[model samples]
Target: MPTDPLERIVETAFDADVRSCRRPHSGSVAETAVLELENARGDVPRRLVCKRGGASIWTGDAIESAVLRVLEQRSDLPVPGVLASGKIVGERGSARETDPLERWACYEFLEGTNPGPGYATLEPTVRRRLVADAGAHLGRLHGTPGLEFDRVGGLARGENGTDLVLCEPTGWHAVDSDTLREQLPISVPPTGDSGRRPVLTHGDYQPSNLLVDDSGAITAVLDWGNAHVTHAEYALARAEVRFVDSYVGRLSRAERRRLRSLFRAAYARYAPLEAGFDRRAPLEKLRWVAQSGSNYARLLGDSRGRRQLWRQFRRLLE
Candidate 1:
């Protein structure tokens, strides 16, 4: 009975064959639901998740579908399978029908909890292991030869190792120029982009996008709306800064050391960073302010954090 346009669209797209449609996630950009799809007799239930495009095809479900297909085939990573994809069927002879990219997609629902801002709720030891696991998996993701491309950033065709589509890629799941503009590259020493080859990056590799099982094991990585074969370090830096800051909250001296030691060791296990990478994390953390800009500013969760981010941006500029 939800009147939201996204809910209506997803319902229409799936038709009236669903047993239940429980919305599990929603944000400014996208909406998600867990559905129990059943036959007329309410038998043979299939759990499925459907994500609606945020505002445009490029920034929403379409990009995710492409990325999921690639991940499902190439990596052993627990990404969902693309069950269906298409634009909502309606508007006969309307101008919207002409666009092919503006489509919605569905995936098989993986069994796990998406622990968004609540990641801090887990036991500290569990959080530590989960973070380390995420780092190691990222290393494997970056090393996939099938994801290698000669361009700056773009998406791959399903797991067949086909070439990427977009060349000068923006932030994943973001088709908007403004959000993309803010995430622009910034120079941070040590893990700088100098000699690094671009690799497949889950542009917004944060907690909400991760699914964890009951034992605190990461079950599936979700949402490639911002994925691209780009400077893997940029992605890594964003991952380290965003994940550590948001999940750990106000990092003390010990927390900072723990963050650096654990993430670097785990990440290096899969994709080793160059020597002296640890020395550059403070610098990278600052650069994260400039590149992420207002989006990260909002994620900072308070006026003081925003001011500090702004001050850091100004200082980094000088």
Candidate 2:
């Protein structure tokens, strides 16, 4: 028996004879709950997860659910099945307003913990295998040839194909334009290449998004809110950074080197390394990095200070 109003929303959505609904503290953008539903006709009930959208960062739940449905129908990727979704109107925010400030979607609960903790204890061989498998999955996503969406039409449907870089205000912001240009060593297009060709991308493909069973095999990849079609190289870069960031602290110096080598090797096997891809090119890399930083600041910053920080961070990275 839950007292929270949101918990009641979960119970009502499932029409589940819910024995209990326990909220889980895992994600930042959405409210997640693990519900135990009782089946009157059978001995065992059902266990499902519910995700309710929050303000600021998670305004795309409806669109994300639609995209996930499309992906599950077309691709063999293991994503959670969407159950139901709608505008949840309630009392909150303003007295003048009739609806709540948030929207929500319910999903079939996935059973498994995050791969981050488990990955730390993995044997060298196992880690290599996981990396290789992840690379393969990424390759398949990137290699989904001829996948197209009507850019103009998608926008109408609230499907933003471009990666949103929010600019926010920060006190500790440093690194000037020249410094940023000097640090990054890669090429950046005026606009992202994703608009040109649309390939499937799990917008955020970090260790936390992957789920592994007791034996350590990745059973499912959750969270499709950020998944969309994008440029292959951009997606690859995102994946590379995620993989590296996840394992960096846990690995020894030698192991870190080996892992990087393995990651690049595995990635290249699927998509040949671009001839002039230079990791040391500060100008290009910094531009992208700066864009990312600015986006973060913008999302978290208030209107008055957001633009200032965004400009400074962008210039510094550029």
Candidate 3:
């Protein structure tokens, strides 16, 4: 009934008095805040990051908590520890469709700064190390044993309630196959159930989700809302676009290539990319381009963005 229910949830979940609660990030689907905690016997100060879910087409706090648990137990990736998780009291109507409870997961506050949006604007040496470190961490994550699945989708509970299963990928919008062909004028074939085993991927892997210290070392990887089961190479291809190619209109061809090289080289130390990656990357990258272009076309009411994406998509095809 209150305007914000997270404070109540935090107090109930941790049984601690809150010093301050400040929302650090609030998106369409979730609100995240850093809560300063004060317990009865003040041994030491504590800070926790609490994420409360809102309506969205993506997996919510439960899956995020599960994914973090798996990573904490299985891999060396520096993800925030799940300190407390529970449903937000009296906040049911604003929940995700798949999940009944408007769940929230609080994490032990990780130290570092989010390497903001200006990846291309960073000093060249700093950019190089950060990219390489991110690539290596991703490689290690994909290589973590026993995380493989058979399909592309978000992680969900199986029928028996003990195992994990695949559900529809978050942010996967329905695109008409017939119209896609007309827009690109090229055969954008569906990526088949490839032979490669699917692995858990950081669904929204980008610079924003990574945190770094002053020395540019990655101290933590944040945000698991988009983690999904997918082919590792497909994920890598997507990363190449986000980590490397997203700056296409601005960065020259050579500059982009250099960044890609740094990323792949670091990634290769942990896991080898499958064969024919170059040929397959374009196809994989097109999937994102089309989906994004479709969303853009809806907002712009013109073909300019689509046409530009078309040119870029075609270049990748070549």
Candidate 4:
């Protein structure tokens, strides 16, 4: 694809006085372009990020843009303001065929830098604070009420909101699928019905999705493509695992304990889970971890033209 084509699309889409446009390599799935718009007619200069869908993954960019627009109107949480979103017609190759890509979204560019790899080397106190902040933000997001979106609300069960971490169909991860029909039981069930509640959650809560400013404060959370309404404990469990993995090397034993406590304590304020019902009991979690190694092995299997299905059974032993 021609690089300038994306810039031209953005320019025409917004009709703003654009100064320059450059592609950014930060995102994994989308074709992202950062555009700088010139200030004119009393309009302030602005930075915008345009995201277009790629071939491999399901582009939920349009859904995310719609959801964020709703979330932005509310004052309780922090979210990037969405500017515009629509399809950009383009011809691929000599076929005179115009492909209508279903997913496209764009938002105002956030100015702060990502909290660098220094997070991996931070002191125990700072690490704990990061986890606490993440947990707090998550609690706030889950606590905020009454958000409605057509596409997000329509996400298939066990698809976006529910953590199907363990129940993904065998070999489904190797290539994306429309529907995965494996309903493995929760590995860790909550003690009682206390943990279940109707609430909003940032379904994808990994550390890379968070944006920390230069002052070490988390300024904004990005990537709500997977956001949805679900049980609050499920969201907490996902966040805790992500936090532990992100700071595994830097946290001392005591620090890890304190961080866990902080996260649980904060999460409990808004949506409390049952006590004593091992929080990590979801079978899906173990299945997900095992699938990671399984995916790795599958890669090797493909290179050698071999089929492997019992990798998970073997992974269970390791």
Candidate 5:
């Protein structure tokens, strides 16, 4: 049996020989790497992306695998196929409850490149299409059914294994300031989705998570680590920020509005926008601000920095 974590997971999952493994740029919550496997039938090797989660309630191999099954079975969204997944076990194949629970999963590698952080610098036509398509894609995702949960929080498999349940929102811990912590407005859950059923939301819908081909159409929506059950309007409002308004400082007001209009128009085809979005969107913007741990950590000790973020937060409301 392979001892190295990567090789162990891959070999255990796929029964394939790991030729090489390389670390790839991944999200803050999960450690992700790509492995090349020697194909027995052909000289070429197969590639798979493996994700390992630390002891965080927000992510795990089982949670992510469950979410992917929903998208694959219920929706038309292009998500990677889960190859194999399980919790890390001991050399004797027994897992101790005292040990820190580390879970891992491997997925078939999708072909495409991330658009990077240059949303404002892309060619005019390409940027517009990408934004519009992303909006539409999210609209479809929000409209996907089979996501039934009583509370507004992250998702976890139910006792039946087929159903999903809501768990406490731990994703907020990443954004909560060490000083202010949950005291910040960003940490407060939005109440706008009251009386509405929680929808399946891609919590981190942004350029970095999307893979695009030469035509600029989204090839795959990557990263289910942030998948959660939330209000449709709340999800839509948050997506608008991720897709457009997060560029507030870099984009002119008129330009931002134009991009937003394009996105809303496209999204409207699949889902309806709520009348209360104007009030809800700003809160989403504040949430986006606190997404960066390093940035929030810096603000924790710096009153001036906290004030600047508050000012921006207030402006979003205005």
Candidate 6:
């Protein structure tokens, strides 16, 4: 097999004559390949993750890099450490210097299994414990004193090298049933100047993004691609929906009840959501799913998979 041109470009990225580079799986908005890097002596090799974003997807790579730095400096969150970041000329020093968005970055590779889809398959006791553990970790993340922001929503890099904003397309308003019925053609219900304060959220915290060791220990929280600032309840609802979904098709009703009990018992310690969280959760879930539709569609990579997302999206609206 001939050396891939992309691989050569990534080699120039790390400035090392690499050994092997391969894509681990299909990614939605970015193409990611795991590269085993050799040190100067070529013996002490390091594993790194290389990612190149698609043309239209701008999920704030710079912001994510900044978040990773904050996590590395401030918390014990198990996330990828940024290795080689910032803009680089594609095929440096060549005739085709290329666009800035065509840049790439490297991160420390994480190793573990994502036990999301088969979460219910674990022993009953283990499932219960994992839920609690997940809740505690989420609480820890939420407990971190969030960065100061002027408003609530997605973050963006500013012209002064630190311009974060409360981006509108980020989350939804917690509207009532009547509002759901009188819905507009807008993404989320209209709630002008609602003072729901923003907090640091995982943006897409769920079982699938968590990596656990064989011993059932949570190792790393992967994919900060969707991490941003949002309403605390908005984050909670998105996570809760995912928790229920993991067991929905796999377990019996009684079994699901058992797990839900365990999940909420732990989640309560962290979330400040009121009794109406469930009533407002559907709208919140819909908000997240809609904004993330393209990313997930690209991850699905097929018509059938994309249709499944559409089905879910429409159901949420109803």
Q: Output the number of the TM-score-best candidate.
A: 3
What TM-score does candidate 3 get on C-alpha atoms?
Answer: 0.76
Worst 10 residues of 2 by lDDT: 150-159
Error (Å) of candidate 3 at residue 79 is 0.2
Q: Write the per-residue lDDT of candidate 6 for residues 265-305, one digit (tens) a residue.
A: 56667544356555566666676677566556554675534
Off by over 4 Å in 1: 1-16, 26-28, 40-45, 55-61, 89-95, 98-102, 154-164, 169-195, 247-252, 294-318
lDDT (Cα, 0-100) at 50 in candidate 5: 84
Q: What's the lDDT of the predicted structure labeled candidate 6? A: 0.58
RMSD values, in order shown: 8.7, 8.1, 8.0, 8.8, 8.4, 7.0
Candidate 5 lDDT over residue span 201-306, tens digit each: 8777888788887667888888776577766655676678777777888777887888898887787777666655565567555655554464456555665446
The local lDDT score (0 to 100) that residue 34 gets in candidate 1 is 74
Q: What TM-score fits each model?
A: 0.72, 0.69, 0.76, 0.67, 0.74, 0.70
Q: After superposition, how far is residue 185 of candidate 4 from its true place, in Å?
A: 12
lDDT of 2 at 147: 43
Candidate 4 regions with alpha-carbon error over 4 angstroms: 1-3, 39-45, 54-62, 90-102, 147-192, 228-230, 277-284, 287-318
Candidate 6 worst ten-residue window by lDDT: 188-197
Worst 10 residues of 4 by lDDT: 148-157
TM-score of 1: 0.72
lDDT of each: 0.61, 0.54, 0.67, 0.53, 0.66, 0.58
Ranking by lDDT: 3, 5, 1, 6, 2, 4
Estimate the lDDT of model 4.
0.53
What clash pairs does model 5 have? none
lDDT per residue (tens digit) for residues 1-318 in model 1: 547554455456555466677765332234567777644233222777776653222222236777777787888988888866667655888756533234567777787777765676776777777777788778888877687755454553333323236645443312222233345453333223432556778867777778887666789887776576656565677788766765455545676568657876777777758665555455445555664664464436755345534544654454
**What does candidate 2's lDDT look like per residue over 225-284, in tens digits?**
545444455556556666664466677778766765676566666554554443422333
Look at candidate 1 and tell me the lDDT of residue 46: 71
Local lDDT at 150 for model 4: 18
For model 6, what is the error of residue 229's alpha carbon versus the real structure, in angstroms, after optimal superposition?
2.0
Q: Tens digit of lDDT per residue, candidate 4, span 88-189?
A: 644665222222233455676776545434566665565566667787787777666554221112222223422212221233122211122233233434
Better of 5 and 6 by lDDT: 5
Off by over 4 Å in 2: 40-45, 54-62, 90-101, 149-198, 245-249, 264-273, 276-288, 302-318
